[model samples]
Target: MKRVMGCHLEIEVIDPTEVELQVAVSGAWDDGQVVESLRCTLDGRAVDVREVRDPAGARIHVLDAGPGRLVVDYDAEVTGRARPATGTAHERSLYLRPSRYAEADKFFGFAATEFADVVEEHGDDAAVLLPYVAAWVGSRLDYVPGASGPTDSAKDTLLAGAGVCRDYSHLTVALLRALGVPARLAAVYAPGCDPMDFHAVAEALVGDTWHVADATCLAPRSSLVRIATGRDAADTAFCDNHGGGIQLHVSQVHAIVDGPLPGDDLAELVAIT
Candidate 1:
């Protein structure tokens, strides 16, 4: 389905002394999906822009500024595509390894024990294992706002037994990798998400194709607008700043459907490009 979605965010920054700020907000791109009608702006200016494409496909905007209050707005039209599991071995090897937040290696023992039977039953089918890992992790954790910080890892979330969207994604991604599935974290603008903040989901490469999974199930997966994909949150953060104690004031995200809502009559797992 072709979906029209975007996000506008206004942030207030305060630096006692004068300081330069460089902001990197994820931009829409073509991977297995295509983004169109894209627009971006910084501080109501015409976007005196510089683009830096990260290794994982996040578009970074390096702004020139001596900040007081900064506003960033981004919008795009996303055309979904069918993603086949056809990546080369090198591509798959990257996500198969552990990352700072995912810590797939740390949870190897747990995953082996918990998902051992499932892996045995499904063999090499990531399609079956992806949903199983999502459902299993989702059941084990409770969603609690402000429960985890930006640096928190899957181990932390598992110990706490609760977390926000990123935490759920981290744990699920970790578990999938432990079971030999290549998975990465995806930052998105989820249209129906409650409170409407930026959201995070996992993309598991199974059966030679990449599939989207949201253990939190906060919004319909079809409504997700891909912003960035990385090994974990560290690489996909909406804002990566280089200086000062800047307070985040007025952070919000919302998306309107171009047409009537798609019926959720399909299965629980929502697979998308």
Candidate 2:
């Protein structure tokens, strides 16, 4: 089996003040493998870790916070999980809650319009629709790391035609939802990636299960790792409620698989500075 890993960061601070925070880390991997376990530390203090598994992928979240300089460390090893055949309608429709879809006035206009068209054009088949959208977004946008924020909307990305993974995933989710597909964003640490590292991806409910797809990875088939998922990047953010200012520094390491190595397995890492 092949493996990939990396890390990322998202920090914002305005000055001196107390902050509340919660962070989640996610990635994708070959299914049917056992994720040995994961350990995470925040601000030099150990945080609580939670695990959740779904058809789309497996995820781990670190919930904790303190004062200035938030530091984090995490490691997990996942084995392959069984996957069901594709081409089935999603059992449920994801309802967009008012509170969840905040800042509608800004996101609903052009962003929603363009996304709706894309979905409508490819609604008939998942195989065709999924990759088409993924490639379209990845190819159309330039990966400009450190130039976007959590609140950046689909319109912002569409206008600039360049952004980080969060922007890419957000735009993808918006478009998927507009086309009547239940879609969400995932925050993950890629173990071996670098530069444009720690990443986010988009997932849409197709057939009876959720299928993972990232425009950034150009529709990561079964190769990419799995992490956490939420309605958008905000829901699956790496850090919790932090009020003061935020700063992020992320790194990754990708290696050709030869055998098991000690320490961390996933390439994605997230750090708040």
Candidate 3:
């Protein structure tokens, strides 16, 4: 299925600041067919943007801008489904480690107590564990918009029992990591999302292939288009500023499939396109 995804961001730059944006669809899917574009402007004038590609294919748009109204626009028309591929040794090792939001190390006890039996039965089977983790997380947390903050961790979500999509992804990723499955988070454009914003979902490695696990279940996993990916939200945030200050004033995201959105089968392994 072909999907159209885009976002508009309005920001206030308090001073001369360096900005990094991960809002574009990843270049990992550069198969000569996907169409995408990104533009940045400050006070109606185009800003000089540098595109830096990460090892995993994330494109970071960087710029140095003085105080002004900064706006970013991105659009992508992604065609075809993602191809299944094996995880590299480095990827397997890296994602298994705990990160800022997905605190895998801190959840060993909780994982053992909550999912030990599933592990024993499925034995690192991502197909089974992925759905199980999604359901488990969906049951554990309430989808409260302001229930979590930027600094909240999976441990925090587990305690509060309420959060948004990122929080759900963090806890789901952490649980899978603690259960001996290499897992990470993917920030995506979800076509059917109720709140209509950037979404996060957990991805786990199973038998070499990586599969998505959306605890929020806010949209069909089959229709999600990947924007950025990492061990947690810290690595995949839409925007970041350093050595200066900026405030996001407005953000609007949109995604739509060319045809009807396909139904998702959580028990099946589906990679984010």
Candidate 4:
């Protein structure tokens, strides 16, 4: 078994004149299987937190007035439960449900022809289809920062041919859905990741478990720390609050596996807020 950990934030109002603010954050993960427990602190004081589980669970939080600094701490132990693929017709049907397919109009412009060819060639196997599509996106799209957003259509990314991680994941999801695979987007903060920048990836149900694949990462065997997942990005956004001015300043992140622990470090696994 392998363990992965990280934290992410969505700062809506960064430069708020008033220190007191109400913040809503979704996608906190701390279920026994993936995460053990999650604790949140605001303005140096701990506040009551809540949890709700649905297809789209409430990893969300409503924060009351506080001080200048907001700190969050999280820990999780990932038990590597290898979701071995079950070659069954029912699994194939579940993956190919009509709801999984994206609207015909939303196909990526640059890879539309090639994506279509992939579907024509391997639509029958969900397991085979996912890796092929993920690798295709990874190799085809160049990672350019400040390129696009969650709602940016696949056509836009393909035309520009350069995008951030989210754009790449979005394009991959769009293509997977177009090919009738039930794919979703995930938000996570990787260890050594810039505090201000959250990570996004793609997930698809294969057999009885959800298999994760990130076109941006491009390694099938690498372990990923998952925060939240949904049909798309709209469902798994990080910091979401209204009526406050926000500002974000981030430094470059460095990944170190074995080093002296820093007391100020955010968290070992992904934090929802």
Winning candidate number (lDDT): 3
Order of candidates by lDDT, top first? 3, 1, 4, 2
Over 137-227, each residue of candidate 2 has an lDDT whose tens digit, in order, gives 8888998776766667776787789988778877776665554455667565443334434467766556545666667663223444445
Residue-level error in angstroms, candidate 4, position 38 = 4.6
- Choose 2 or 3, whichever is better by lDDT: 3
**Alpha-carbon TM-score of each model against the true structure:** 0.83, 0.63, 0.96, 0.65
Model 2: CA > 4 A from native: 2-70, 82-91, 95-124, 189-196, 218-220, 242-273
Per-residue lDDT over 1-273 for candidate 1, one digit per residue giving the tens place of the 0 to 100 score? 666555555655454322222222244344645453323334555445567786554666665544566666565555654342244577599999999999999988998888778777877577888888888888999999999988899999999999999999999999889888899998877777886788899888865666788889788887766667788988777775666545566665666566765655224556544
List runs of model 1 lying over 4 Å from the truth: 15-47, 79-86, 264-270
Backbone atom clashes (below 3 Å) for every candidate: 3, 60, 0, 12
Model 3's TM-score against the true structure:
0.96
RMSD (Å) per prediction? 3.8, 7.8, 1.2, 8.0
- The list of candidate 4 runs beyond 4 A from truth reads 2-4, 8-42, 56-58, 66-68, 79-104, 108-112, 149-151, 189-197, 218-222, 243-245, 249-273
Per TM-score, the best of the predicted structures is 3
| Per-residue alpha-carbon lDDT of candidate 4 for residues 223-244, written as tens digits (9 for 90 to 100) | 3345556555555655444455
Residues forming the 10-long window of minimal summed lDDT in candidate 3: 79-88
Local distance difference test values of all predictions, in order? 0.72, 0.50, 0.89, 0.51
